[model samples]
Target: MRIEKEYRIFEDIEEVRIFNATKKDFYKPTPKEFDVEDMPFQELLNNVSTEIHSFIPYENGKDFIIQRLGTFTLNKYNSKPKDAMGRRLSKISPLFFDILHEYFLEVYESHTPKKIRFVYYNGKKLTKLSTAKIVFDMDRIFVVTNNVDTATNRRVDADYRTFDEDKTNMMENFSQTGSYYKVHGKYVWSQGVYNIINRAKEDSDDFYNIVFDLVIPEDQHIVDKIFYLTNNETSQCGEVIRIRTANGVMKVIEVNIYSYFDDSGIIIRQGLINDITQRSDYGLSKPVDFLMDGFKNSKKLALLIEPLSKKQYEFSKGFYYMIEKDYGDYNHSRKIMKNIVEKDVVKNLNKLINGELDKIDEVLTFKVDGNSNNKKIVELYIERFNYNNEVHSLGFLTDVTEDIEKQDKLVASNEQKVVLIKEIHHRVKNNLQVLNSFLNLEKRAYKNDPDLIIEHMQTRLTSLALLHEKTYGTKDFVNINLKDYLVDHDMKTEGFMELPSQVEFETIVDEDLNLSIEVITPLLLIIDELTMNAIKHAFPDNTATDNKITKQITKLNEGDARLIIKDNGVGIPDSKSISKNLGCEIIKSLTSQLGGKISLIECEKGTAYELIFPIRMDHTIN
Candidate 1:
């Protein structure tokens, strides 16, 4: 069995009438006068049978047409709107035309025909409003005023119909600000809006001859979709979009729209488009991007640097303008750092980038060409980011004049304190030498004593004084190099032997080793006692031609130190009895002071002594 369908939608004095000829379905003979004002468009479209096509809202003064209503019409005939009518058989209504207007205009707001999901109920359970759907013609929704003549770059006028004043004044104004629809996405009635847009486009003839053509090709569908959103009844705000200018230049702008629907079903739209190219969040007013024009007024010069490239980068004249005084990578280093203070800052900066320094809050102050009054102090802050496989640093330079003045004053005070400290060290070293001289004078009185105790006392005082002599030789008064001390002490003690020219001395020190004066002093005195003992007993047969002394100091991988001394000499006749000697007791005390052990072993050709101790690195600051 085949089916035929037809619909009649007519309006009378009191209510609208809708009838389906095929099924003989009617919503009402007199759709009982319900106030259209109270009727939400959804409920009214719901009340009518889904077979009414061509919703013609006819009034005495105005003509309105609603097409593409197949879901409501249940029409089997799906054809295009008639190009030239042959005759009126329920007036040439088709599925596409009737349902397009039904779902988009009547069922919802003025939008391009799209498949919208709507819940409905004939009598019992809720279901989709229409199984039939209409494809969206996103192109046709925007007509006439949107037309752009490729040659002239001009907008064509959209035809309009005039109505009564007081009631339609808002509609007339809306038509001027925003192009609007009259017959729900079918026709536009914009007079003022098209005129203003055309005029604005004409005024900026050089760059954008067609201002009304500012609508971006891709954005047309979005604009249509936005106006049709369910709850967006009254207003829509701040829809930013990209638009083409007269010369096809892209610009960013913000648009706002307001919807006005009168009781007579007259729809109006009002909108505002503002160019935000120079907004703070955009290019012109930004910290980096604003440098084109804004930096000419700024007292400081901000640089855009690429450390990896280390070269000049051209600025876009229209977008970015480099200040003539600003330094690029090629010249910035030499230009910024002329004085010692600033040069030191550059050195430290390299250290920071090389991972040698960890401090970030660096400040440097310098005077330009000896002008003390023109001192400028800058507190630098840096941030790092990775770009193009290279780590880059962005730095902000801010003047800190007041803070630097305070720092300079404090630095001068610190310099005075440093001078005072250095003088004290000088005095301490000199006082120690003077005390050694006083002891030498006192030892003169005990010269006649047996075993020459006064002689040993004099040698010990001389060794202690040598420590101060070494301290005064270096800039750092606290820490001393063990290797340098060993070399110097060996040279000084060579002349103590009766035949010093015949004896050969050799010293071997580890690659990197340093010790404090406190540790070296006890060891120096121990070496002195051993050297004196070697001179008295080592070559007892008066054989200086075969005499040789060797000293070795090494730092082990396990953080311990070893000292070895060997001399070609007659071994101790009574090594046990030597423990009773005052010199032996002193050596043991000195070894204990260093927290080490001393061993005496007679080798094949000489006597050998080995000292082992922990290499404590706790003492750093003087």
Candidate 2:
């Protein structure tokens, strides 16, 4: 019995067409007579013992068509008899078609069976996730699909249970009252302690900046705390201070700071702040005695030199450890400084020593002769101070290699963003020039036909607009998905023609094809002009029952690309007619702009053009 059916093809474009044919006509190779051993699994296994949820026999031909689907397969997909009986596999599962297509090609070539596990979302919002497995038969190209969603969910639930138990145990050991915070340079992660103290949460507030503002103005010791922490002189400190909350309420809090060297040699500071406002004896009058003994064990290198004599010097234990030496192994500070510090820094140090400069503060890059011989960037500060009736210089050297590297990377990223902006500007300027040229041509050629001029100009501008729209919708600003751009242009062209239901439009583009903006802009204009011309001139009577147009793009071998635009309308009568057509001239010009050659393809029903272009790999415009 013959039945009429409509189906759609391609993932990006919904190309619909209606055709009437017998049920057997849908399968290309014609389904073999149903036999027990001819089933999908019977050919794979000697004995059929397992259960099958969805068994689909697909004909491997130019188009992957489903010969027939088992009752279970129909129920699993929630499809009707007519839909599953004689339809393309892509219509059943558009998202999974590419995967199935790849497997079909492999099995067709090598005659080797394949198996794949995939997840399918059924609903429109894609809220339900169902896992399915496809197993290919070597002898027969049918697929055995089994829904394994239940089994997969069991394993996922077990993982969640174990994670919940671990999280519960961790929460039981964590302190709920004290707030914990960690700071590494400008990055800060906290447990909302500062927000509670401020009495209001602010998205833009920085942890360290907020803490500094919270400390009462009279508490000048916070400056000293920051200095010691910044120089990595102390490992831990505790202080009781008064802070005014956002509500103008004064409260007492005890803050404990701990500093440690991370694996990358960057110092990280962790803090815990406890509110002690209700306590009667909060130790408000007591002084904060910083941990001065931590200097010996600290990672920072310190130096004390008698500037006048230039002979007496004392180096911290960190300096000796850094140089791979024991205490008193290197006595002369000048000798050690000359080897590690840059010559310019040493010259500045001499200036400080000779009273030419009051102090010297700078970041200098140098390499130390140590076990690893790694380059070190250090922030150096030296100032002369009176001690024991003698002129001495107390200087601290903090390793800032990691911080400086991070800053350099940030600067490089900003510069790259600027270059991208400039490229975008250049693309815009070029598009404007092209549009202006079209305007001038339209003025000279079709001055009397204002409506025709506006129509052509409108479609050209729409083509450019759609190109930018697709390019901006994606994360990649340099190139856009070629298939997506073609589908969008097809839709806009139809909008211009206002023939939504009259023409059967289709786009069969390679899903992986992407082209740079420089190529796409001109390429899209050419497609638009050709497609619109066919729609206008191809179907003069607009009564043909099989009016169809198709746009296909595929990657060719040797780094070339092919674009084909064809229709089933009346073919072009004469080849010379194209030479005198203005639209044809525009198409030729645009094809040349892309460094591509255009030629007419011989088709039985209607006109077809093939454009071969060298794909740009560098994604840059000349």
Name the best candidate (by lDDT). 2
TM-score of 2: 0.44
**The 10-residue segment with the lowest total lDDT in model 1:** 8-17
Off by over 4 Å in 1: 1-466, 469-473, 477-479, 495-501, 617-622
CA RMSD of all predictions: 23.3, 46.2
**Worst 10-residue lDDT window, candidate 2:** 7-16
lDDT of 2 by residue, 1-622 (tens): 2212111111111111112322233233222333322334534342333223222444544445454455544454555444554455565545335445666666666766554433222221111222223344533455554433222212111211212333222221121123333332222324335433544434333222455457788875874565455344456677877777776766676777666555565445555565566553654321111222345675656443332344544445665655556775565545555555567887887788678886889787656663235667877777765421235455666767788889999998788667667777787789889888877887888889887778878888888888767675453655578887777777777777655247888999888887777677888888878887887778877566778888888989647899999988888999788767788888888988888999999999889999998666456523
TM-score of each: 0.35, 0.44
What's the true lDDT of residue 351 in model 1? 72
lDDT per residue, candidate 1, 1-622, as tens digits? 1212222111100111122222222111111121212112544553554432333332420222333232323222332223211222123333223323333343234433333222222222221222223232421221111111123433222322332323232222322223333222222323433333333333223212133346688776655455444124333434766566444445555566545554664443434444554452546321122333443444444333332124422222211122223333234344434543666777876775665664456777756544666666666655444421235454445556666678898997688568646755765675467446534544564456634554555566666667667775554445678888778777766644344436777889886877765567667777877777776677766535868778898987556788888888777778789887656776887789777889987688777898887666344333
- Candidate 1 has what TM-score? 0.35
**Residue 379 in model 1: lDDT:** 67
**Local lDDT at 587 for model 2:** 85
lDDT of each: 0.48, 0.58
